[model samples]
Target: MTIEQVWAQYRQSLKAFLHTKVASPNDVDDLLQDVLLKTHLAIENLHKPTSVKAWLFQIAHNTVIDYYRKNGIHSNAQQEITWYNEAERNIKKELAQCIKPFIQQLPEQSAYLLEVIELEGKSQKQLADEMGLSYSTLKSQVQKARKELHGVFNACCQYDIDKHGNLIEYHQQATKGKCSPNHMDCTPGVRKKSDDKYAHCSKG
Candidate 1:
């Protein structure tokens, strides 16, 4: 598919396909980006015109599985938007109260770390270099900052309740060591959540 053709051909179909698999509109949007990127890359290597729809659908399937693999449908990606909306609906006043004072309570470095890393999406190494600190020290600071913010958010959970008025469970189920579908091995790269964080933790 050409650029124009790709958009025209796959946009709605991909959106609908992802909507069936995911839980929220936010997830739909994320998967849409994934499918389109895959489609654009595969468009160049098109060998069979008749199989375009199948090819695109296969990409969509693989993208959804990849999302489940990495983020595991249990991480921030799912509840990230849901929690934001839930806060907006049930507790705007409590949200402001907790966040404003918590920001003020953070140390200058902690505040800057949260802003740059959580809010602005800077990596730990980038923030460390910018602040003239060692990367290890910067990451340690970020972990501390995240722990503190998690505390504040947990405190505000006092106001967060379901229709039955019970506390909603919002913990992320950390991805397990096992990989699935094909490559399940004891080897380094074959494990699930086999990112650098695991290596660092294991060494420490």
Candidate 2:
């Protein structure tokens, strides 16, 4: 399909599909932008008009799966964040504002660990392997990092936690199963490990 036709026909469905999969509305916008940009560049390779929805969704699904593969979700929590008005956004943004100071105050190793494992979403095993550290060391680093992050949160923000002690905004999902970067990672129950037969670009 032509690039323009692809964008015109599939953008909204692609966004909705992503909205369901992605927890944050802002993140959904980011992912949709990435998908459409990639689709625009690779549209020439898509040959079937009738399959556009499936095709775009495949792209959307893979993009989000890759994010999880890299960043891991926040806390293994599945509940969605609710923001009904600008006031809510301001509150969440205010809560998130502590993030900067939290990162800056972290010791170098702790900061690096958080960036790699938390921000980048690599599995503990994957990160430990890459850093050439033993699993035990990596675990220690993660604990240290989380502890310091908590301290930063506590010191900087009154809204970081509720009286019940659960974090206010931490959200995460357990990956359904392992996926190789060399292959496609499907949704937990719906897909099994398979090669990326549909990816249009080699670099993705």
Candidate 3:
């Protein structure tokens, strides 16, 4: 079959597979285009036309891996800290607001841990003590929670950071309602009173 014909048959299935792995509809569209482009360019190299379905999916799978790999590099590059001006601080706060919903969507224990440690500005050691857990165990849990939280955020938006590790920009994809706050569980009382302003924050 021709490339166009093959793509027509498999595009919907590929997109469905991508949606499960990708949190953003925009990214899924972009990745589908990437798969199409690669398939078109590499089709000449395929010796077996009967294997086109497997070949197309292999390209798609690798494309997803490459997407995360590039983002992972950017994430690591943002480890360094730098001073922020007023504009940068405002942007950071805005990004923080967008993040709150994703944190709330985590498992109850993880959500609670992030809400207390992050939004409430409580120290991990203090939380460990309050929860009657050893410092090492609490630390490990916190790391896992943070990692899961990062995954949720990464799937929703693409972040841009400067050389000094400052967040400069972000692009939200077309995945609406995925990050909406569960207001019943995400009430202001769940956070410290000092953090009330950040409560009920939406992706808007």
Candidate 4:
């Protein structure tokens, strides 16, 4: 069946599914559009026509999660926590896997700086002392390295962040843009170090 025919057959069921997750009619409509877009872009990858229903529902599920993540609305903490445990672990893995490759793509110095500061979890002051560079110089290099890493991620995917600045979802970009990097800089605000692993940085 054609894409339009497939959509027509499942649109009502999809709408009903979305309604169960989203309370706002307008938000549901918006999310349905997002699912439609993702479906259109990815349908050609569907190998089995018989699997269309499952595939469509998967897209709907992810779109709903993206919506809640973007809105920072966790209506069900237990459900959200379960979802987060699985999803966030995958995200961190993806981020870690991409790090070395992208960092190697940077200038040698910038690359080394990032490898030590970010991957090794070294303090900036210690790095500065070891390298015999002024703290200001080390800070500048760290920032530049971070920006370059951010560009690498941006080139790969466009991330969606919530109001509280937590990463919710990431959609791969169709094309590469100039290496303009943006990092997730989180501050520790009265949170213990153990509780604030992301206090320094978060790339999602």
Candidate 5:
């Protein structure tokens, strides 16, 4: 769809769609900007104009997922907006809630490394130079750190992947443990929580 049609037709619907996923009006407003930028960047790639509605909603849905990925579903991100119905306990929230704690489970420098590269939008080579490490060594460290984090998360949860290999849902299999999905309360992300220090950990 053209930018004109987006403004005339899809923008309000996209906002409404976002409201259903986001709990706070302020959060929803911020995500609207994110959705618009993503939509603007990707809109030209869409070939079928008739499918614009579904495409727009998918963008909004993925934007919500990214929001949760960036900011775990902790008290800070939660809000009581009467108009918004609590939609099915948000699989994304349940899935992302433990990410901060899991990252903490890693070594201190590992946590810092992931935060810089993944959350701060830093390139691995750039981080390597900044830290006075060789590029190849830094790349290997990044890969190893990611693997270690993945192994830790895998021990605590089992994901339900669809036929297309897309994650449809996930289940918390761990009881009382450090990596347990319900074990931590955190304000994660590089956005609103940036001022708190050591911004949290996710990318697109």
Candidate 6:
């Protein structure tokens, strides 16, 4: 997307998110603008950014940190800021919003399995034991379910993958604007994701 489009879509949201971290209106504006410029410049340099919303917020996040650092704020005081915690929640919220639609579109078995494994946090080993299958067999079944979920996702949006089978970028189908990035950390289970936003839904 062009810088203008991104700015129009996200400028106010960025400001609101920044306000939760930075108090001054002027500073928030400055940080938001900095986020725009940084995003514009770094878009090409960074590993291909799949989620523009997440990418912009992360820049805003670092801008907040840099703002604190430049002001010579004590590390202890900086640690008190809670934007990152909120940011993490927002991303996971987006994940929940975006993934379920695709999941529901899957075949019933695939959909149910994904719900149990990824959404319901069921233990694959225990599930396998209950079904009289080995752990490896359950893992394979879960993997196959995730693969079907990935297929449903791709049917809605085109994705670009890097050499190592990592998700690099994506373009959403215009009709599917409600679909947000999965942010699955390349693992579609109930496992917690690290801050690696770009690698979700990899072929690996």
Q: lDDT: which candidate is best?
A: 4
TM match of model 1 to true structure = 0.36
lDDT of each: 0.47, 0.49, 0.55, 0.57, 0.53, 0.54
Local error of candidate 3 at residue 89 (angstroms): 8.5
Span of 10 residues, lowest total lDDT, candidate 4: 184-193
lDDT of 1 by residue, 1-204 (tens): 343355555677777767877888887886775464334323444456666665666656656654564332433333332212221221222222223344444677777787666444456766777889987887788779857754543332212225432222222123242221221211111112223222101111
- Is 2 or 5 the stronger prediction by TM-score? 5
Residue 134 C-alpha lDDT in model 3: 85
RMSD for each model, in Å, please? 20.8, 18.8, 19.0, 16.2, 17.0, 15.8
What is the clash tally of candidate 5?
A: 0
**Clash list (residue pairs), candidate 1:** none
Write model 6 residue lDDT over 1-204, tens digit each, in one string. 544456657777777777877779888866765564344334433344456666667667656765664444444534554443343333323344435656777778777776765555456665677879887877787778867766755554554535432333445444323343443222221112233233223222
Q: How do all models score by TM-score?
A: 0.36, 0.39, 0.39, 0.39, 0.40, 0.40
User: Distance from true position, residue 29, model 5, in Å?
Assistant: 31
Q: Which residue pairs in candidate 4 have backbone atoms (N, alpha carbon, C) closer than 3 angstroms, thus clashing?
A: 151-181
Clashes of each: 0, 5, 0, 1, 0, 0
For model 4, how does the per-residue alpha-carbon lDDT over 76-154 read when each residue is reduced to its tens digit? 6336423222322232222333356657778999999977765565667778889999888888887788688667655
| Residue 201 error, candidate 3, Å | 8.7
Q: Can you tell me which runs of candidate 6 are displaced by over 4 Å?
A: 1-94, 161-204
- lDDT-better candidate, 2 vs 5: 5
Q: How displaced is residue 4 in candidate 4, in Å?
A: 0.9
Candidate 2 C-alpha lDDT tens digits along 5-105: 45555666677767777789877876775565445334434455665565556556556765565454543212232221222112212222223334556
